[model samples]
Target: MQTKGSLVGDLVKGGIAGVAGTWVMGQVTGYMWEHEDPAARQRYEEVTGGKYVPDRTAEKIGQILGLNLSEEQHSMLAQASHWGLGAGVSAAYALLRRRYATADAAQGLLFGLLFWAIVDEGMTPLFGLAEMPQVYPWQAHARGFVGHLVFGVVAETVLDVFDQAS
Candidate 1:
């Protein structure tokens, strides 16, 4: 098993990386909207269920990074990038909890998805942290469900590695 210290390292590294990576991905989405194929926008929009607004996405990402991407498709790409980052965070947290059974993974996931809603959809837009549109309760659930499940699985796998080491 990894020493407890290493586990903590994983937790911190995972969380920090999740946040930073998510931010960059948001910006990248903004870039893609501007530079990518026109049909890409329609595909992205269809996939995102019309939640992909290029201007708002660009505004949100620019607010976080202090940069501008006015193109519609690049903005969409950044928003799209969030799927992986969200999944990574979920997976990392799941692993952390697995490593330390005492870790409150349920709580972590609850706070995480809710945070995604309030912060990503609610507070970010509320405070102009990001210009993205607000999410409804159901959408929050969707984000929570997919994200937490992925996280749980990833975390379980990580713990399995520890078990092997032990």
Candidate 2:
């Protein structure tokens, strides 16, 4: 039988694992964003009528507050939200895993896809921070899909490591 304190400890560990996963995902995304073909970036800009940048956490936050922040500030805010969301998702995953013993790659992939659906395709568009995913260039969408895939995989791996260590 698991103690309440143990459960809470697992949640904290899982959240940290999620942050690690998010950091890895962020690096992959940052590299892709930096090295994407100019033509492809141009196409994205044309379709979105805005700059091509991965992770619109700041934009969504700004939209909610109706504040137009500078580019640097927006980037900072985006990073903060991105990490926070990653941790929250991981913590929730940890709790679910503890209950269901569903700590595997397939589940992680599903979690990532779920996030893509809810946050990327749903909330962002609903809040006017982004257009519907369908409207973006196919390549852009593919990139995002892969990034989330990495996030899920890494998060699950780290969570398992934490479990083993404990």
Candidate 3:
């Protein structure tokens, strides 16, 4: 049996992941992404008449990091990631509260992000601990900034649910 797969626990954990990741990425990599550039991707949406736009994590860190996910790609990817994250965090949060309560889901969400950015990212590419080789558009970043927000928000909600339980 899983010890902490409940809604609250998962949300709390996810939130922690976001904040922690944000901090470390900012400090270590000196890069943080929050939104897509209006110039490139924004124009594409206008041209294609696409309804979706890329949203950055903190503020598209592309300029700073010199890594290219592009305006169009970022916009589409962000949406997919956001959806997945929301689902994952909410599900986890609901399950967590069945067993216990924690007064720190928001903090938990933050921590989860921070840990993933600094520790988790390196696990695959850095240490080769295990090869996850490839991931989908959203999965590549779910654990990044996109997923954490889902974690934080959902976890916070789950914690509130736990409060009701008690």
Candidate 4:
């Protein structure tokens, strides 16, 4: 049973962990993308309309708000949205961890899978932020899965460190 202060502390730690996880996930996915076969990558780009999902989402949001953002502004907004989602979701994961010790089982692998399925496989397409999951090349799906797995592991490890230091 966490006190209010402890809950706040947990959330802070989780946000930091999430930022770290997001950075690492980006690196891993970037590497995968760079090494992906040209034809497959081109196919993915074609099906997904050639822009990164976050960028597309940002553009759509800007349009909705009637803000004519420059390209740089759009890029910044896209990055902010990406990191914000990572931190926000990870903070929720931390709360879940507080209630259920089992939530940390497999070093957050299940949490990662749930995140991938709910956000990547389901919500993004449902919300029109991304193309349907089936339209992507298998490699894209593989990269997303691996990246989330890494995110879960990294976030859990950081939280463990925080626990040890406290």
Candidate 5:
């Protein structure tokens, strides 16, 4: 069991790892998008209306807060929301890892899949933050899955590094 200080340290490390993982995931997905079938990519763009889900989420948040956000503000908020979610989720994952060794069994691959399923395939649509999974092409799902797998692996690796350093 980790002492309180070590747990906090782990959480901080997890947040850093999450940020790193998210950045790498974005790069991977962007590359996939660039190389994707034109037809499928066009279909995805059409279905998504060229707007990012995080942008939609930011807009919705602004509405709830009764604040009218400018386009620039919306974009900034969307970015912040994206990074914040990544960090927050990974921090929670760190806590889980400390409590249950099994959580680290697959070097975070299972956690990544679960995160993708629960957040991407489930909660986003359930909360009206994104379209239903069926609306997207198989390639989109595949890209997301691959990106998340990378995220899991990268996060786990970073956490391992932290462990070794400690």
Candidate 6:
């Protein structure tokens, strides 16, 4: 069992590392999204019976708040959501690490997959922000999986650095 101080250290260190990892993830996914296979969108529509609009979550959030935002605003909101989700996941991971003594990479990978399943496949659809994951093309799914894997690896690396420093 970790003492209270060590637990706090984990929270701080993990949070910092997570945010860093998320930034890296964004950079990676941003490039992939820009260069994504154009045909993937058609496949997604065929599978999901819907259009694949990026950052629909931001639009939904705006609708919920009775606010209308321009394209630029939506883009900003999407960025915010990306960062917020990353930070939130990292913080949760920090706390979870307290109970489990697994290797960082393994734990991070599991966390990434769980986050994808819960957010991409489950919550997004449940909240009407996105179509179910089944509707997405294999290319889209692969891109997301790879992006999250990067996040996990980066997060674990940073966390290890912090652990060593402390």
TM-score of each: 0.40, 0.79, 0.31, 0.91, 0.93, 0.78
lDDT (10s digit) by residue, model 3, range 89-153: 44454455445544455655663565356534554335333223242133334435554444454
Please give, for residues 74-140, the per-residue lDDT of candidate 2 as tens digits: 8788777768888988888888777775567887898888877787778767866677777776778
Q: Write the per-residue lDDT of candidate 1 for residues 1-166, one digit (tens) a residue.
A: 3334455556654554355434544454455456656665555455456643334455566777876665665566566555544545544654545445543446544545554555456654565434445323344334434543434433434444544455
Worst 10 residues of 6 by lDDT: 45-54
Error of 6 at 68 (Å): 2.9
Candidate 2 lDDT: 0.77
Better of 1 and 4 by TM-score: 4
Comparing 2 with 6 on TM-score, the higher-scoring candidate is 2
> Which should have the higher TM-score, number 3 or number 4?
4
Per-residue CA lDDT of model 6 for 97-144, tens digit only, reads 667666467767877787777777688788787776776777877777
Q: How many backbone clashes does candidate 1 have?
A: 18
| Deviation (Å) of 123 in candidate 5 | 0.9
For candidate 1, which ten residues in a row score worst on lDDT?
134-143
User: How close to the true structure is residue 109 of candidate 5, measured as C-alpha lDDT?
Assistant: 93
If ranked by lDDT, best first, what sequence of candidates would result?
A: 5, 4, 2, 6, 1, 3
Which parts of model 6 are misplaced by more than 4 Å?
1-9, 30-38, 41-54
Ranking by TM-score: 5, 4, 2, 6, 1, 3
Lowest summed-lDDT stretch of 10 residues in model 3?
51-60
Q: Clash totals for all models, in order? A: 18, 0, 37, 0, 0, 0
Report clash pairs, candidate 4.
none
lDDT of 4 at 142: 95
* Superposed Cα deviation of residue 43, candidate 2 (Å): 1.9
lDDT of 5 by residue, 51-162 (tens): 7779888988999999999989999999998988888888888877787645343858987888889888898889788899999999999999988888887887787777
* Higher-TM-score candidate of 3 and 5: 5
